[model samples]
Target: MFESIKYLQKGNQKRAYQAISELDIMKHLAAYNPILCGTLPIGIDIACSDLDIIMEVDEFERFEEQVRELYGNQQNFKVKKLHIRENPVIKANFWFSGFEFELFGQALPVKEQNAYLHMVIEDAVMKRHPSIKKEVIELKEKGWKTEPAFCKVLQLEEGDPYKELINYGKNTGFI
Candidate 1:
């Protein structure tokens, strides 16, 4: 269901749809399941929000090679290998169609990746508590990353906000 950009073609996401479609990003990265994640999808994006595309990649080297071949020549293109939560990840960043793009890949299912999970939970929270969106956007504009802003607004004062949000989602039946 996350494969298509049809939903992104409406509302504030229309520009993002145009950018991704113009670049044919999904078509080129079809081998790995790619799902658009992060602030834009959830409608809490600020002026500087970048497009975040999460992919399921079993081999970092191959993923890096493919990303390099596809976007390495783009403006400000750069790829690097890093580890998050002890899991190896390959990330590529570049500017295209007036948008900054972040391609993140890990050896985990796209649906299971933390970025995707966070987006899902954040969306649910916003849906359930509509006013939270305004607070989130304000925090984001003030340079707060999505998760930390969420934690502050939600009063999730303890534990890792990232992991705690998942649990919060479960407890609130928002996940």
Candidate 2:
């Protein structure tokens, strides 16, 4: 059904299919709708980049159990527990059929999803400076964060680059 939807990246369609399949399985198993967000959608992903995902599901323990049963053992897949603004988040890294999955699960409201907001702004900035994608890839290779790399390339230094980029997106109607 997604064949008509053109993906910006070369292999993103396949990756997206796999991610959606997993999410479908999760929804069937745990009833959660997880959305994929990150640089891959805009075709500027770096080697160190993760497939940033967000979900409003609070059934992480059940989800973990299902993952463990499907993938076998915690050693094969690593999970890190963290808190954001006092709310719990589960960060996980796992591989299936050579495709690495980096998933972040939480129960936050849709409007409060910062990752999605950041992606929108970064995409707007990259659209303006087409060459910034290459610069961002180079910066990521040099171990720099994506946001700061984008800011440096775009010359948005009036304060927080993240907020500045968001404002640019809003002003330009890219958001």
Best by TM-score: 1
Candidate 2 residue-wise lDDT, 48-138, digit = tens = 4565556565777876675557544423588777897578887677765445666677777533566667777777777777877888888
Model 1 lDDT per residue over 75-103, tens place: 99999898898999989999998899999
Q: What is the lDDT of every predicted structure here?
A: 0.89, 0.64
Clashing pairs in 2: none
Tell me, what's the RMSD of every candidate?
A: 1.1, 4.1
> What are the TM-scores, per candidate, against the unseen true structure?
0.96, 0.70
